[model samples]
Target: MQLIRAFLVALMLCAPAAARDLDGIRQSGQLIVCANKNAMPISGIGDRPGFQMEIAQEIAKELGVRLSVEWIWAGYQARYTDCDLMLGVARDPKPASFLRYLQALTDVQVILVFAGPPRDVAFEDLSDKVVAVPSASLAHFKLLEIGADPRVAYKSEVAILQAIESGELDAGVVSSVALDWYRHDRPGAALFALSTDILDVTSHYPLTIALRHTDALDEADYHEIAAKMRDDGRLQAILARYGQTLSAEFDNPYARVPDEISEPDSVSVRKDIVEELEDLARRNREELEQSAK
Candidate 1:
């Protein structure tokens, strides 16, 4: 009997701890989120709490709970932290089996950015242009596949944008999230994002929140919250504050939205080498309209 007792204790010790469900979270009066301390404009501990924090705050408000953040330094550190929510999680075709994804908050796509006036630049047109792409990125590989011979010279989105702004390169392809933050930081700069409507790349994905699979919240529950936020314009307002927006595919649920775009398993360049945190300022409406001009 002692041996059996010892075995049972060992089993209990090895088992993972149970996460607090919705009711438990409400009872605790706090919605805990794991956020990166250095991923600025997304999550951080600077003057601006970052959009991820802002969105998580709204979620906590919806749940009628206060917000509690546990800051980590990188994405890999999330595994070591205990939290109820993770924001800005990229939606994958083959999602992690242990987690349940909420309705996506916004779409992130590869965009072609350059200085000067905006003009429609087709994917085919980039064949002869000198462009800076993040090293070994989906856009980098695509440029090579199309014989563009893009300069794989930059390690971060900010570097690529800086090169373009200085006229060192004709243009650069970066994730839309980077473009949004860059434009926000440099509102007076002439740099603009040119539409790459024809680019068939795997760098596009939707950003969503994820929680470990639990009985507390089902997919329908998640979707209802997202739809409510979307219908009430809260979701759009959050992105707008950071100079970001949803892609056409996942922009509005009430509208005739297209199907979700499938993305590769590979990760994109998300972390910036130099993190900048400023007040959450709204980009002018005309500037956004001029981006597509």
Candidate 2:
């Protein structure tokens, strides 16, 4: 009897963590999401809710679980959190670090210029020009690398655009996603004005949904659900607002992942990066003209 008791205790001690499956989530009735704080247009803090939060809410609705967000900056210890999901995660393979990626969410790119500029503002062409850049953004680094004159710093992408509109800055560089949010919210903004000039430089990359698996067991089934959404074009609709349409190739990194686990989707593989932004701007302009009637 003592030997049997010892065996049972060992079995209990050796038990593995649980996998987040359909039935498990149904029983819990809650899906906790972890998101980076202040990532505007994706995940925001305080009053402004990012679109990724909306995406998480929709995922919870699909899973029949109540949605909740656990906000954290980069270095939050995962051992202390109960977060089961995350959205808009950059596809990095450096280290799993206790997280599993389910599927690619959308593409991300930097848009250098908006409409109304007299000339195209390329990085090599910034002589005698005042360019507004969101502090610490990819564009900011690139501007410095090219030795741009008078690089004005702004707190946020929205602030950069506002400075341009207020005539405090001649032009600004911002991410396509934030610009998409701005055009959607303020469709009547001064894109129709003649001052918005074109700046040169554009690129894109993929963003994925990161999963904090409760278990190390392969999550093929959970991934299938996200794949279903991608195949049905539902995900495309969400990304299209920001001029991001998923690549038709669907080069899924989650499948057949090797042991190395590096930034598989490292560089922005997008070819027609600026064209997508222009198309969005053109469509919005036409809609604005119609609404003016």
Candidate 3:
């Protein structure tokens, strides 16, 4: 009887450890999420949490775990592979670097807007005007493809929108989802979506969640689970609470490997870099003031 009792105690002691090893995750009863604090509407730091935060919470609930968010500032790249997951990543299959362990959950659109005569403007007519865009932003690349000449690059979206409001630029590019929120709160600001027929730059931005890449799980496991969530309507319900929906046409694309894989590199902005950008912005502002005068 004493031997049997010892055996049962050993099993009891081993159960939790076995579970932890099987899942290969921290046994803290929480899922750690790394998120971009500046990507508004999707992920951002504010009094009220954004859509990505709410979605991450839902995913954690579905997994029977708690959600723990760690907001990342600009130039912080450690979150790429350090956390259980990272929210608000785009699925670019060409160079799948930094997202090998992630699976896309939904699609988002990029949009263009202009402050003009009416709230209903067309894309073709935008050829004659300069568009304010953020440097190194997806919208900036899209604008370049659409033949927007003399693209005026700004340091941030707020600056771009401010330029548009003050007539510093004829138009601006922003995330379509975020633009919706901005328009809802601010009235009399004429905003129009450029006709997709002329310059269709709608990108399928996949909201993704990351896991350990070296773990012995297949990508199909994640896809199957996500598909079940969608089929059972749980995914839609979750998105509805956050006022978003899945795109009908786009499927999450996957690539077997990335163009490059390396440790997270440091991003340093030299004083001269900032000075040059500031000088350019000042020149643009002065030019706008002169044009207004």
Candidate 4:
């Protein structure tokens, strides 16, 4: 028994991860997706169909497999579990363990008001007006910074919309992606009368779709999915359903380049400029030296 235990320990020390690749998962006829079970508009296993679930379904269709979700809580395995893809994660270190650069998902922080927007309404303009912000969200912090009297409410986007319709909150904030679903389930022209796109969120975060290093997909693939959704009028229709346009970042993706692409280009361009400047400086120095001689 002791010898067997020692051998197992040696094996564990030798090989930590087994090979879980795309071809094998595809052959199994299921694309196992790891998703947040409670996050709204993004993903959750409930009444409101999540956008991440829709994305997963599309990917499964693209790969010719069935979609299966593996709901995760605090700690299990985002990588080694019954999941090959993790959806709707923020730009954080949690997905850094995986080996892929996610250049797709568009995210932004903005606030919406239930009433018809006043021309050029500012934070001070909302000071006297009752406003509701999602607790602990970027909007909540922004509202606090602006010193607006904010009433923090539901964490769910749909619930937030319901609260707005029920005259509970004068205004509320949520991820634009989640708003897509809200606009769909509830149809009303007066629901979203104001979108505070002018909000400054230079330090805001974005949601991402993370995949294993060996996974067979790229940013272009996701783009194609979005393009199809747009062409078929499914995605845009959902946005219009709420009288809300796409968030600034998503209205045009190229407006915000991915760090993976932009970082390298910036480095290369700066290197070229530095090299040219150095050569010019050297030539000028040589000319001055010859003149002194």
Candidate 5:
């Protein structure tokens, strides 16, 4: 035990110090945020850098510093990088061991989407209609419990939406972010995002700004900044450009934080972004089939 303790102590002493806390970061005149290059509508490297980047830029301006991005393929692994900020993190009472949930920025929910005439979809209305949800998902299980008989053939939100648009499916439950991206891609689509008030299971969660567990700034400081942005309409203005929605702060006891601190999954943060577009081309096949029929 003594040998193990000594080895751990030696390693700690040999390791580099934690990245600068808020004061030091401000002194450096730069705030470094870790981002995924391919995660569109959240974080991206293309001409249209995602909303997360835009939000970070606003935050940096508020802090009176320049924003610098360290682009990575996966954002969960940012804990190991020399970055201080990570955007679009799910808010949790207990954040990951390596990070702190700074503040809730936006609302992410599983919305009911369908085409035809624009009208709100009630949960009871789903019983008689065929609906689609990702296989083995909470939404799927809930639909089964309600006797909705949800279809799970579609693997991605985009595919499910396309199926609905092609009249191959009736309705779908998918990420609001995915819905926004879909709408952005198909501006003239008749699809509508209906009720987000799904019961039983949690259909909504808040997206937050996560700060590395460093000395730079405490949770309250970041919270104040977020509150200011929310009050002044800057946050909403930024999200509006990307079709995102702001969420009021709320408590969530059942939600789990990232506990796998040793080796977090590289795919964790990028999964939603990837799944949103996966099998999107399948819609083309559906279109051809519809034409044949």
Candidate 6:
């Protein structure tokens, strides 16, 4: 009788453990989050916490899980693969092979910075001056479209701003939110906004959560939740707390380059580029083999 009573007590303890919801995650008890440190207002390493970190914490709280942040360097390719989810990513409906999920939170503005006598200058007037831009960024492509010299390109916004400040570059392009932060911190430096609007005023690319392709979460799930948050003012409240706002409609010139310039048609343009590159590589390899023979 004593043995049977002990067995029953053991089963009761095991049953609750077996039926526990979120066992998969609770076992870990931590949701790993990857963030780009340079993504200002969205994510950055500074005294003030970024908006992305705030939103991510909220999500983790809802999940009843702890948030564990892993900081990635400036380049996107190096650190995207190490985490369960990424914050402040631009939305890509058909993402890269490894990216399974993307849901945008806000659109960011891209603006031009120049040390000038006036508050603004037109884009057409920038033809002759050296315009520094971050490599692989929307600003770089925009500068290229307008025939700006590629030699002036820098790898990060920090470099671009440094070049502009030191008079090495005539102008630099940066996110407006970051610019506001910089201005607030440094009242003496006179950084003026350029009047020349070469591109349409765009929103920051839809900053989203990027997850692995094999993750359980899907786009629909993310969208439904995100849209609800947006609708109920949850997202707005979050942004407002960080001194920012959720974009009403996507229109940040610095975020994603327009479809007209780099169309997202998977079956058409990008496919052709990929194939052409592959063909070129194959031809080069064949030539090397023939030489070896």
Q: What lDDT does each candidate get? A: 0.67, 0.59, 0.56, 0.57, 0.70, 0.59
lDDT of 4 by residue, 50-126 (tens): 66566667767877889888777522345336576777655443233444434445554454656443455665566
Which RMSD values do the candidates have, in order? 15.2, 18.0, 17.7, 14.5, 15.3, 14.2
Candidate 5, which ten residues in sequence have the lowest lDDT sum? 253-262
Q: Give the true-structure RMSD of model 1.
A: 15.2
Task: Quote each prediction's TM-score.
Answer: 0.63, 0.60, 0.58, 0.57, 0.59, 0.60
Q: Please, what are the lDDT tens digits per residue for candidate 5 over residues 1-293?
A: 68855654544343322556788889999999988665557777667677878888987888899999887664545634668888667766555566777555666777788888887666777777788876766678777877886898764577788899998888888778878977876888888877545534445666766788653346667777777887898888877777777665523323433353222445454544443333333444465478789
Q: Measured by TM-score, how close is model 4 to the native structure?
A: 0.57
What ranges in model 2 sit over 4 Å off? 1-27, 45-49, 73-80, 134-142, 145-155, 188-203, 214-218, 230-251, 254-293
What is the per-residue lDDT of model 2 for residues 51-127, given as tens digits with 9 covering 90 to 100? 56766766777677898777765423332456777666665545355577666565555655434634544445664
Q: Give the number of the best model, judged by TM-score.
A: 1
Best of the two (3, 5) by lDDT: 5
| Candidate 6: regions farther than 4 A off | 1-23, 74-80, 97-102, 116-124, 127-130, 136-169, 180-204, 214-234, 249-258, 261-293
Off by over 4 Å in 5: 1-18, 72-75, 112-173, 184-187, 193-201, 214-217, 250-293
lDDT of 6 by residue, 29-66 (tens): 87667777766666777685577787777666656789
In model 1, where do residues sit more than 4 Å from their true spots? 1-19, 37-40, 72-76, 118-132, 141-160, 167-170, 194-202, 216-219, 246-293
lDDT of 3 by residue, 172-259 (tens): 7766666655654465666565633345544435555554332445445555556777788876776554556665522545432232
Candidates ranked by lDDT: 5, 1, 6, 2, 4, 3
With candidate 6 superimposed using the best TM-score fit, by how many Å does residue 57's alpha carbon deviate from the native? Answer: 1.4
- Two-way TM-score contest, 1 vs 4, winner: 1
- In candidate 4, stretches whose alpha carbon ends up further than 4 angstroms from where it belongs are 1-19, 37-40, 46-48, 72-82, 89-109, 116-120, 128-130, 145-153, 193-208, 215-293
